[model samples]
Target: MSLHEDAVLVLKAYEGRDEQQRALREVYLEHLAEHPDAMYKPCGAGHVTGSALVIDPEGGRVLLTLHKKLGLWLQMGGHCEPGDATLAGAAMREAVEESGIASGLTLLEGGPVRLDRHPIPAPCNWHLDVQYAALAPAGAVAEISEESLDLRWFAYEEVAAVADTSVVELLEATRARLGA
Candidate 1:
């Protein structure tokens, strides 16, 4: 099946635990139904992006990359590629690629932790971000990729100081999921 079909199924099966998430899920479904090209990057107006907040198992820190283009400390994520089978797969692939951890990365048990719709540069107006949480195994080492100016693990408290509001929100949602 195509990524679009897979995304439809994933979204349909997901049961949001909160009213805000439930509303966001509906919006995402509606957006997907309205735009068949929503899963691809070249949609022109905007498109879905998959991202993961990689957390250490101890839950004290998260891996963040200083985005090369935006120059902001953010979670690891990017556009969905043709090879991506599902939104979650795209997020995992991005996490592995950006974090330089080839193995021992596991997604949180629940569905996506949050949905963030944010504006991007021209050629793409917005990124409908499906965010998930990934647990990095003990002793997992991260190497910076070309996409990032720098990559480092930040304490939960430090996230707010360094990252933008979007990243901070993602981190809060991820932490709530971990505690749940």
Candidate 2:
């Protein structure tokens, strides 16, 4: 099946634990149904982007990058590429690429942690982010990529003070999934 079809199935099967997630799932489904290119970045209206929060559960810390262009502390994520076969695959790809952890990084199971819709510069009006959390193996070391100005691990409690609300929410949902 195509990535678009996979996204539809994933969203439909997503049993959102909250009203907001359920609402956003519908919006994503509608967007995908209306625009076949919604999985690509060139979509004029908006597009689906995949993101993964890098979490070191044992260390009780989360990895966040200072985005090169946006200059904000955020999770590793970006536009979908042609090679991406599924939304979760795209999320995992971005996570590994941005985090520079070549191996042992695993995505949290049970699908996406959350969905966030945020406005962006023109050409593309919005980024409909499907967020997931990746479990970083112990002793994993991260190197900053061209897309980031800096990369570092922050204690779970420090996330809110540094990252925007969306990142914090993703972390909370991830932690809930982790049962921490």
Candidate 3:
């Protein structure tokens, strides 16, 4: 199946934990149906982005990148590429690419951890982000990518101090999934 078809199926199967998440999923599905370019960056009407919160094996810290353009400490994630097979796979690929840990990073099994809709610069006004959690192996090492100014691991308590509320919320949801 095409990535677009995969996206639609993923969203359709997603069971949101809250009213806001459910609403976001509904709108995302609508956008997908309304715009053929919804899955790509050139959509002009915005597109779905995938992200992963990379947690340490001990569940003590998360790897966050200082986004090159946004200048904010955020999770490892970005636009869905044409080669992606599933939203979760896209998220995991982004995490691996951004974190520089090519192996031993496993996605948290349930599904997406959160949905964050935020505004971006035109021609795309928004990014409807489907967030997932990835567990990094104990020896995982991260290298900085050109897309980020910095890549560092932040303890659960330090996340709120260095990152925005969205990152904090993602962490909370990921931890809840890990039962940490």
Candidate 4:
């Protein structure tokens, strides 16, 4: 199936209450089972595209986007697109597009260094997120878009204190995975 088709399926999966969504997810999982490499190994409800934890090098801060749809601060990411051959590459592209950072950004080798699975709330199934680490200099300026109401950098500790529990957990996991 085309990437857009896959995205549609995913969107449908996420649009329902938690229990209802789980049923829809089983259908997607059955589809994914046919194409193992195009998705990920151990493919199931949790297997989806990856996300990135972007860090500003100078101030030791992290970049976060206020997701328009979810109204929550989240890492820049989504399902992989057709142009992307790997989950990591799709994550890098999403980061650049969502953050509007023009400067060259590089992924930390051996990252997104963490992987985990979480439910997408009700009406939508679940996404198995593969998380990576990306580092950029502190001087980088972000250009916001409709996808986010705002984008900013926060000190790691400060971010942990303020961000939602799930985000905080991801941040902590990224730090531990990257030893940063």
Candidate 5:
């Protein structure tokens, strides 16, 4: 199936933990239904983006990239590519690409951990972000990518201070999934 189809199925099957998330899931499903090109970056109406939070459970820390364009310390994720077969694969790919921890990084088994929709610059009004959590292998080291201004590992409690609410929320949901 196409990535668009995969996104539809993923969103349709997603059971949001809160009213806001549930509402966003419906919005995403509708967007995909209306726009066949919703999986790519050129969609003028905005598109579905995939992202994963790289976490090291044993170390009690998460890897965050300082986004070059936004200058915010955020999770490893970006626009979905044409080659992607599933939303979750796109997220995992971005996590590996951005975090530079390519080997042994695995996504949490329960599918996406959260969904975030936010406005972007002109020509693209919104980013419907499907977020997942990627667990880093113990002793994994990260290299800096051109897309980021910096890369750092932040402890569980330090996330709130360095990152925004969205990142904090993703981390919380990730930890909850890990039963931390």
Candidate 6:
């Protein structure tokens, strides 16, 4: 099946849940199905992507980036490509590329922490975000990318104070996975 078709199948699987979620996924699936090639190319729209919440092994901190476009501290993530075999793999690839972390970085074995959808402004559909969590050794420095204005480690409490409301759930999920 085409990526768009796959997206529709996945979204349909979640019907009768949250209204906002259903609407956002429907919008993305419709747009994507109408423009299948847009998936391979950067739709110039935010488009659906994956993200990673890189947690410190000590369980005290998490790596976050100040997104260049959104101007808010968030986990590393971006547009999915046709090359990705699965959504999880796509999330891992985007995390490594955006954070400049080595491919060898160990990711948690389970699936994503959560799925979120949000509009990316005009002329483009929303992003269907599959967020995952990974553990990195304390003191590991991220190579940082142009995609973000800055990368920093924040304590869990500190993160709660400043991170976007959209990301708090991810942080909580990551922390729970780590048993922090």
The 10 consecutive residues of candidate 5 with the worst lDDT sum are 9-18
lDDT by residue (tens digit), candidate 2, 74-129: 99999999999999999999999999999999999999989999999999898999
Error of 3 at 67 (Å): 0.6
Error of 4 at 142 (Å): 0.7
Error of 6 at 145 (Å): 1.3
Q: Each prediction's Cα lDDT score?
A: 0.88, 0.95, 0.91, 0.66, 0.94, 0.71
Model 5 C-alpha lDDT per residue in residues 1-180, reported as the tens digit of each score = 999999998998889889999999999999999999999999989899999999999999999999999999999999998889899999999999999996999999989999999999999989999999999999999999999999999999999999999999999888888899
Candidate 3 lDDT by residue in tens digits, 15-80: 887898899899999999998778779988899999999999485999999999989999999999
Residue 103 lDDT (model 6): 46
Q: Residues 1-180, candidate 6: write the lDDT tens digits.
A: 665555556555544235665576576567666766545436655466778888775758888989898889998877777777656667778778777777455677656666677767766656768677877865677888878899888888888787987688888866666676
Clash counts per candidate, in order, are 0, 0, 0, 12, 0, 0
lDDT for 88 in candidate 5 is 96
Model 1, runs deviating above 4 Å: none
Worst 10 residues of 4 by lDDT: 8-17
lDDT assessment of candidate 2: 0.95
Candidate 5's TM-score reads 0.98
RMSD of candidate 5 to the truth, in angstroms, is 0.6
CA displacement after TM-score superposition, residue 155 of candidate 4 (Å) = 1.0
For every candidate in turn, the CA RMSD to the true structure comes to: 1.5, 0.6, 1.0, 8.5, 0.6, 3.7
Residue 104 in candidate 1, Cα distance off native in Å: 0.4
Q: List clashing residue pairs in candidate 3.
A: none
